[model samples]
Target: MQSHNQARANAARRRQAETGESYAAALAAIRQDRLNEADHATEAGNPPVDRGPDYFHDKPVPEVLTELVRYHSHRIAKHLYFAMDEGRWRSDFAEWQAMTLYKLTDAAAHLNLLIGTITAYLRDEGVGRYFLRRYLQVNQDHQVEAYLTPRVEEHLAGLTGQPAPEHSIIWHSVGSDIASQSGWNHPEQHEALEAALHALYGNYPDDDEAFNHLPPALRERVLALIPLMKDQEHSGAAD
Candidate 1:
């Protein structure tokens, strides 16, 4: 029989293949699911523990949520850049451009909704808006590189033939980072965000930005094989 660790590693690899998540992210999800299951089993015999909306483990709620707001805001900044870059990529690749923008907008909408709710709950719109608007203000100032150096670094690494690093290396999008923190303090909102994400991208809304930023010719060749990849994913699911 396979050892438990081997089973978990295999499960994570399958998840990474199907969801296009980095290996660390897929592993994190697997571990988190196990934890959630264990917690649920434990709670089944006990009374539910309820807390106030503003409760963040006794930390200043607004302060912590504001940081969550920053995380989403940063991701939204990257989406905006990618949306424009798609158009700038080449005037002739209209299908690719349209697909990118369509997916990106769906991605942005999720993040925007998260920002709006976080601000409303904090009862101070300025708390979120100030940080969000600064990202937008990159147009008037020379803040693009300073604001998005991490994203640029991914593309740079890809150009040099490096594989995508583990999630710890790019902590910006860790589970407790931008992607899963969508209203996590609120149980209902957390479930809703999870559903919306699966619906929007058929997985996570994030693209492998580094892979997408590869030279157009090479990227196109890979994209053209996507249907075959989909078949592989389905077969893995069956197993």
Candidate 2:
């Protein structure tokens, strides 16, 4: 029996042959139809997990790196909550357990890819060294963080002698402008950027010169977020 996706692929091939359409175009159309069906299913309150590509897979290298760092950081943050309250929850325990298991399994599948992507970016990007340092500082996974931080620090220590705070300062600075230009419309992107910035700023609590190494425009944007960072610090202290 032909599976649904197989049937769709066959139909797409037929359409491609009949209309002289590119295979890529046919596949894109099929994907769009599948997405539309998924959207309809969601609207009917029976939301389906699409489980397509990871959010960053198709993005440019810089954006991919940004999202990779943000995603893992968010995962680590959630793990902290899960760790602290593993058995205390009563309501939604089943659902939470299912989702947590799924995320853990899924993340494990992608761990190697995530590491490879970051390594590739660090090797290829023009400001790779700076970004590598920032990633090391901001990432909360202690095992990988401990391993990579010293290696990166040692490699660049001779030239710069310290971590370059400007990478994150510039990344978040540009990210804010990008988010604002979209009128802060993309809640998911905004949330991801906020998480990334929180992680970045959280690592440099007392560094008054954190943004000083950034370009003027980027520095201005980063400096503007000091109040928010301070607020986070206060909230953390209260907790």
Candidate 3:
């Protein structure tokens, strides 16, 4: 009976091996496909910067969120750039532009998942739930700034409403926390940024400074999201 069971198990194993996909192989294939697509996009004038696992991690809430937005924005940009570069986009006129804008907006909305992750971490910290909720509102402001900042000035202006005391202080601390950290490494950083900018603007910025220095259109996008940054500030000040 034991021999029969062993034979049956061996047969099952052989069958599984013949039909099943290896998880590692599948992952490797996916990565290879992505890399190929990225290379093709770059050749077509869109650079690809794959955001690796290391780029996202445990860090101060504000800082991590801010970086995530930056990183996420670049990914969206690269994705779009490749889409257009590969001739996947059908049109480039104003109507098409509007559609592209919507895509970018959608990308921004999708990034809220990352935002939620950071918010949860902050909540776990000494930060209060109320403050985290408000902080989320402020983080939205930052996203508005970094994403739409380059596209709309008036929008950004309106986005930066009078930040409450908590929002102001906490947001900066977060930014400071991220800025102080030893990140921004990895090769894809600049390439992703450039691709994102080139897709939105006619030209890409030379560096993060150049990108941030972009006229109110892009700068205001990030600027628009600042009020939420102040939520923690107000909460702390309230104490």
Candidate 4:
């Protein structure tokens, strides 16, 4: 994995130099920093950055749901970048673009799961219908909403028994919007962003395949750690 990441980073740098694009160069730098961090942590006998609390903990459901959204949102953003890069390089534009869309759909499905879980938790907490209705309102103007698959929207509408709010942040789309914008705009910046994503995540199975393959126990553990990891990343950035 490390070698693969390094090779991708090198390629990104070369691309950036050839095209005067900054995206790949920026990504290579970030990847190097992360690799260094990982090495230092391993040497110090510290747990990996992503290692976190077990899934079946007694934490508040809202908290757990929040973390799940954060974690998957990060993953989805990485995949989105990769898909974008694939679109840039591959001759089969339609196929690559469809793959990208599939990744986005997978992201939406994961978020829908988090929303369902949160709703159930709110009900248990005795949040009244009025409050719940207000809670579900789409209050934000987020670009991430553009990526939400129609199927996921339909599924959420079925669950709510009303049309899903056309503009809600239910999936924590705010975080996704930020992730998606990290290396946007200039060509170099975009390529660098793509390089960083490829280095970090490589290619993973599509969302449905990955979700279906997970054992229940492992899945829960992953759910528990997702938010915790996000918190750690934020804290690290702050520091």
- RMSD of every candidate to native, in Å, equals 18.9, 24.9, 24.6, 18.6
Full-model lDDT for every candidate? 0.49, 0.49, 0.44, 0.49
The segments of candidate 1 whose C-alpha lies over 4 angstroms from its true place after superposition are 1-61, 123-239
* Candidate 2's TM-score: 0.31
Model 3: lowest-lDDT 10 consecutive positions: 150-159
Task: Report the C-alpha lDDT of model 1 over 91-114, residue by residue, as the tens digit.
Answer: 668676686778598666646455
Better of 1 and 3 by lDDT: 1
Q: Which pairs clash in the backbone of model 2? A: none
> How do the residues 85-144 of candidate 4 rate in per-residue lDDT, one tens digit apiece?
767777887788788778777766655654654545455445544444455554442322
Evaluated at residue 82, the lDDT of candidate 3 is 52
Model 2 misplaced stretches (Cα beyond 4 Å): 1-90, 118-205, 213-218, 232-239
Q: Worst lDDT window (10 residues) for model 4?
A: 203-212
Candidate scoring better on lDDT of 2 and 3: 2
Clash pairs detected, candidate 1: none
Q: Model 3, range 1-239, lDDT digits (tens) per residue?
A: 24322343344455457768553343334446666975675567532243222223334335444554565455565656654653455655756666667666666654553454454444334454344445455544444234322122221121222223332433333333334432432334744464444444331221223234455664655434334445766889999
143 Cα displacement, candidate 4 (Å): 21
